[model samples]
Target: MSREIVLGVDGGTTAVKAVAFDLAGEIITSHHESVPVQYGRHGEAEQDMNLIWEAVADCIREVADALEPDDTVVSIGLTGQGDGAWLIDEDGEPVRPAATWLDGRAGQRVNRWMRDGRAERVLEVTGTTVFGGLFPVLMEELLEADHERASRATTQFNCKDWIRFKLTGERLTDYTEASRSYLDVRDVSGFSTELAAELGQTDLIGLLPQVRAADAPGGVLSSGAAERVGLPAGTPVGMGMIDVAVTGMGLGTVDDGQGWLILGTTGFVGTLLPEVSRRRSQNSMVLATGRGRQVLEFMAPMTGTPNLDWIRNTLGLAEVPWSEIEQRARASRPGANGVVYLPYASPGGERAPFIDTAASASWMGMSLTTTPEDVLRSVYEGVAFSLADCVRTLDMAGDLVVSGGGFRSDLVCEILADVTGQTVVRQDAPEAGARGAAVLALVSARRFPDLEAASQALACPVERFEPDADRGLIYRATKAVYLQAREAIRPVWPVMRGLRYQDSAGDQS
Candidate 1:
């Protein structure tokens, strides 16, 4: 018996997962470990870089330990949270706690660029609009706050690439991760020095790592990493793609026009396009795909499950179990009893359909008749509607692959199906990112010729939520109300910001 298995490790926002799979993408076993994230002054989100590595090592070890006598782990692949600057020195050691993608310390820099038309100029070359907490502006923050530490930095990589560096002892990143940063997304190649110049950070161009293609060798696992993960030292590791990019692939949504939504720490809505359409917008990223004829157009709103998590923790709903919370949502009518929630509570604001950094979440048409359940249910609908808005922008037309924590709730899936008026396919694999990483590892191991074949053979969906015609009609009206409210609140956002600022100053006095 050929005990050949490929392993994939995913470093997520709040947890790290390692999942093992056979050649046809069937799950053999999986292990998970929770990790810590620290938030400090000025919207800062940081995590200990070493803890992530240890988590990956621990999870990998757990999975490796479960292997039968003949079981042999062939190749390993990695995926992680996108964005947030992870800095390391020439020696490949972290200089400080890695800045997470959620960190907003660089909002001011983004605002400055947006105002001076510098953002527009850079977008011309990169074909990407600026987002708050992105790497280019975040790099400026590191250099400005502490030049000494910044000077020692020789290379910068995304969260996933940092882990790959430890495993393979070679620093490199794939195009998917590169496109998330300051790289030239138009051609899907290397860094755009011109974009760096517009941001007034020319030096950052050199710190970029060499670009590596997917399924290509990302150096062999070293003795140190092998010892920690209980794997052979010479095992090949492939340069993995972004978590969002792999989620669709893991679901086997490879055919042209196939699309999916990932409701993780963030809400990502994407579709596979037939051509490389380089339409530039703050809400979308145009990416070149492995198949020369296809491209990926995606938009990720900064708020997703995190927004809902806030409602539970901040609104005293934590005492009630989430299962009960789901029941409340399910009890609520389609319109949440006429109460509506805008999920733009994120400081980064809304980035889909339109880019509004100052956008604020609001409850429109709430009344004393509204119950806590109504408010909570509206939040679920609010997030789904936001993602639906983005999907409309991409024009994704097909059965939707919905994967993430939010989708675990049957109510959430029902609402997505109704709101989008499409069948929502939910897979049994909870760790879509890790499973996708396994798909990459299998490709690197030559288990199947390439990704498409591996995906078709291995990817499977266990549940399907088809749209209810009656409910779809109801949600069509519900979505209209949501959009109208969104427009109505635009002018009020500036006033809201001013009042909040004034309230802060008054409290200080």
Candidate 2:
């Protein structure tokens, strides 16, 4: 007799991953295909929509090929990176390349909205702060800059929704992705037309896809998709939440007051709430958790492990192993010998804890005496400090659940715990987003009664990093200096941006 397995597909910014898991949530097989991101000189990050779908199909085919002979795939669930504009025409063809969440071309519009109180009107209705990469902002930009292309788009899909549409012919979105844009966190009506009108994006109201509950039944696999992926036709699919919300579910953070963090390409710190809270950071949002009325408040820093990637390559350590890097970081003290590094290395600038499109990374207090080890350690500590900032802004307390590729280092987890002054519970699931999708698929398949029961059955913790009191005290003082230094550099960001623009223009000339 063949055992049943659930397949989960996560289409991320950089890759599309397909993972299969048994009923108990243990991984059975997995495959991933990398999707390229095109970065423009004007702070634009995009991906070819069709190429992304192709990657998804390829990944699924690989996973199916690796499946055991006795293992029969039962259900499919989909999740992906949230935000940005993934638009398609009536024929389901990409009207243009996807403008991802990292795109900052609409920075001027976001700034103007912030200054004119239009952003406030949006926050009042949506419970989300206006940012450059948000759908409405991007749509406004695209409509003004390329009216022809923009007019061709008939429906706006999120990353996963686009993939789901291609697989099951469902042109729908879930509540979680909807909350990132115009959805009122306080209401279940989905899109807020009034909010769209406030932003002068009323034309986009008709382009919005029908919103569905996260655990609801997504359409089944089509014959064409089934043949391409080597899966049986009519395999059930679940409407999965956005990547962040689904990842929280995968971490077993289903109850109110539960918190989680992801230190991946970006750093995210989130706390679940029983109700929508009015008070939130400009960089934080009150997002729907996809469970009825439950919400998540989170701050996402633009860059996370990329700081390490930057320093490693810049310092001629690209070939060096991460174990050596951790060793060097450990050689330095908790405070990194007074050097404070800001982890905003993204070209599009920082978003969470504060929205600054001109923000850039800096190493304050560096001296001739500063050792390489100190610099490396400060980079790690800087990212941790950023996470701590979000935790404090959200007023989150208690033990913090941490995951992602960055937390693989014991030293990173220890630093996070000490800097945040909280116990950091490290969960070792590498494919957390996919696992969460699989959990939702199980519920959609009626194999589980509810999300909580399904998640609890798969909850696994391999290690815990308790905060050191002495180190915590040291980081507290250092964090004060970090904040002071960040504020001091605020005025310099615009000046820096201007200089870069002039330099680029000169190069072009």
Candidate 3:
């Protein structure tokens, strides 16, 4: 008797990972292929679509090879990073390099809309604020800046949608991805054509793909893809949601009031709710959970482990191990000796909890006696403080189910639990996005009745971190200072932006 396995593919900004899991959700085998992003001088981030597809193919082939002779891959689920514009022509070829979610070429456009009240109008209709890298905002910029690329584009697919098209030859997107900017937050599956017209993007209506639920019946594997991936032709393909939604599912956060956090390339934290609430602040995204009409009030603040990465690299500690860095960081007492770091290091600047493209990282209260360890530990605390801000904005009150590469350190996990005042639950596993996609595949294959059932059956065991009373009190006081420092530094962000570009202009001239 052959063992039944499901395959989950997560096309992330850093890599394309293919993970195989049994019916119980235990990982059987997995493979990853790194994908590179091309970063531009003016907040432009892109990737070659064909290269990403090739990486996905390589990962799938490697995972297929790892399967035992008696093991059979019954279904495949797909998920990836959401937002930005991946333009494709009628023949399903890339019109240009994909504009990724990290791209901020449209920052000025977003700022224009915000100043003219168009940004708030977007919030009113879509239940979310506009960011530079959002699909619609990018589309508006592309149309005005690059006529050739805009005119050639017939469809706009997110990262996973592009991969799905290559696998099944299907052009479709799920509600999770669509809800980023297009679908009405009140109506998960409905398109807002009026909002499209208001943005002067009515042309986008024709470019949008057919929206479906994450577990809905998607296309089968095509013979060409089967040959390339070494999978059986006609294998079931599950229409999986975005990495955010699927990661929540993989963590078994299906019930209302469940909160989850991802501390990867960016910091993401959200609370699951039964339905959309207009009363909530519009700063965060209101997304379809891809499990019935459930909603996820989500925020992706531009802060994460990258703060640590930046400091480590800048201070010539790249060769040192992360564990050693953590040890040194721990030597510094709580509050990093009065140093508070802001973790907005991304060139695209900060979004979520607030939108500010000119935002940059800073370390305040640094004295002559401050040590490098203080700087390092303060970076971790900055990220924790940012996540706490998002949690407060969304009213996410309970245990936070946490995942992502950043949580590997005990110090970060403990700090996050104390700072947020929530018990942090972690499953020490990578490829959670892929695991979530596998859960969706199980439901799509009809082996499970619904998302909730599939998720419960395949859930991973967790390790919990309880908040320390003393540390929580200290964090509470520090967080107030953190918020105050953030606001105080806001007035200088634009001046910093001008100084940076001035240096660039001097070099160019």
Give lDDT tens digits, candidate 2, residues 69-133: 87878789899988899989999999999999888888888889989988888777777777878
lDDT of candidates 1 onward, in order: 0.79, 0.86, 0.86
Deviation in Å, model 2, residue 28 alpha carbon: 1.2
lDDT of 1 by residue, 17-89 (tens): 9988876677888899999988754557788998999998999999999888688788898889988878899
Error of 2 at 104 (Å): 0.7
Indicate the residue-level lDDT of 97 in model 2: 96
Candidate 2: Cα lDDT at 55: 91
TM-score of each: 0.93, 0.97, 0.97
lDDT of 3: 0.86
Q: Which pairs clash inside model 1?
A: 24-458
Distance (Å) between predicted and true CA of 237, model 2? 1.5
Question: What C-alpha root-mean-square deviation, in Å, does candidate 1 show against the real structure?
Answer: 2.4
The positional error of residue 235 in candidate 1, measured at the CA in angstroms, is 1.5
List of clashing residue pairs for candidate 2: none
TM-score between candidate 2 and the true structure: 0.97
Stretches of model 2 off by over 4 angstroms after superposition: 278-283, 503-509
